[model samples]
Target: MMEIQGIDLSIIWSIIIAFGIMMYVILDGFDLGLGILFPFISDAQERDVMMNTVAPVWDGNETWIVFGAAAMYGAFPLAYSLIFEALYLPLIFVLAGLILRGVAFEFRFKATAEKRHIWDKAFIGGSVLATFFQGVALGTYVSGIPVVDRQFAGGAFDWLAPFPLFCGIGLLLTYALLGSTWLLIKTEGMLESRMRHYSRPLAYLLAWVIVITCGWTAYLQQDIAQRWLHGSHWMLTCAVVVLAVIALYGLQRSLRLRHSHKPFVATLGLVFLGYAGLVISIWPNIVPPSVDLWQAASPTTSQLFALIGTLFILPVILMYTLWGYHVFRGKVQVGDAYH
Candidate 1:
């Protein structure tokens, strides 16, 4: 109920934070997916082209993660603290993977045969570690972080579970689909053809993973199930499912037709729809079972202060980001530099 200028800052920050999360998932998700798919491509030149595709925009893509975390800490201190505490181990590893991958990006481009190969491995491993942990964290969050007396009461490794593992695999597949579709948009000839060949399989895999994860979450979490099983919310859930299925179908068709942009758009739509459904299912809840968004929100003053900067700077960031993409649009080739 905290208000600022007649508007609820809690809801404002929540929307802003959700937007940041979605952007991070879409932007950084593709590059990390490309990194995960790196090792599978035997040709060194192919890897170079893949790296080049993301090079101009990769650093910018990752900025949203930092923004999201910091904003949550400022706007929803309790939820941020509890979620981070519950995910301490996984968060540490996620940071480490991101760092390792950043370093590998530099070294792999500069080193000779042997050292480059080693760095390449590092790049793949790092991306896998980061993306997997992110997915695990998502699953753990959805399952609910243990809370006692309004504070985190879970063990460090509480998130280490079969459901989280399955989620990790599912997220990895989803990201790979995004990456492959992006490659289709940013590549041509042999690499693009290879991506087209791979897109159908990745799409199918992602579709199943989404279904399984949705079923598991619904079955295990009563509130979430109820959200889907009753009321008009069920219609919303059905719409999301239908939307995802349509996107997948469209993606496959786009790949077949060699539509450079449609596959990427379709894949992004699936991710967006899935994300939207999850948010809808857990609307008021921040950390789950009982920690509703209002309960987890920070003071109105804090949110208002944060919004001053966010409201001003976010649009600027968005503008520049779009401009950068426009400048870098078109196919990326093997000889292009990482920058």
Candidate 2:
């Protein structure tokens, strides 16, 4: 098997999965954020416009998660099993939420006034459930789930902890920030005005949660803290930190200056910064201290086949994704819902 400067196919596959995971979090994240922000909107027309902004492309956003999961299962079956076993309950809840969200998206548009409220609530509830549990699962992953003999050894409620709960709240606020910026771009009139007002505070709140979460993660994990604080890694960590700060400032500045695209761009930058930091801190180790990427990777033959298929298919996916976004581009007015 050929190697790219000693980096094997396994590492390449891992990077592919990592990129897919990041895309899922950032893309679908905004829609989930919008759904979570629904209760704050009392005006039904405003809510409809907000939902319409994401209607044409929301399901497509979720496809990235499926790609990520499939890559994980195929490329790193051991790590995937460990994660699934440890997170089975939260994963189940997340799936239920996604299903409910899909159903709510269709029914809300056709319902009577009173029934629309019910469907709207279902949408919001699903978004909240999914985002909160995702955060919780992340916290569990960061804090380290118990494993024995290559399997999850923790109880069902083992992930129920203060840090996970805080992470849940943090995720909710982060999504809210994304949703608000998204609304500012896709809406007009009083709704857009309200979103612009809310986006700034949400940005500030997201910054706070990010700071606290990073500090807590550092304090909590000795190995990660040591690696991140030492040598060139520390410098890279500092650079990422600076970028995060700039992103936060840009988000607020764009909101103030009424730049339609800048706020969302900056928001995506912040999300990427966080994802990069997490990946750097956990590099090589797909499941932290116990299992490195190489140890968990599938055989080289499997990886070669997968990589070949990925090379052929990924560009096509990217092209259509780009085209879809372009086709759906523009602000969603009150009565302009696609379906």
Best by TM-score: 1
- Could you tell me every candidate's TM-score relative to the true structure? 0.97, 0.96
Candidate lDDT values, in order: 0.89, 0.86
User: For candidate 2, lDDT tens digit of each residue in 235-282?
Assistant: 989999999998998888888899888998999999899989988788
Note the residue pairs that clash in candidate 2: none
Give residue 294's lDDT in candidate 1 (0 to 100): 83
lDDT of 1 by residue, 58-79 (tens): 8899889888999999999999
Q: Which candidate ranks first by lDDT, i.e. highest?
A: 1
Give model 1's TM-score versus the native structure: 0.97
Q: How far is candidate 1 from the true structure (C-alpha RMSD, Å)?
A: 1.1
Error of 2 at 66 (Å): 0.3
Report the lDDT of model 1 for residue 210. Answer: 88
Off by over 4 Å in 1: none
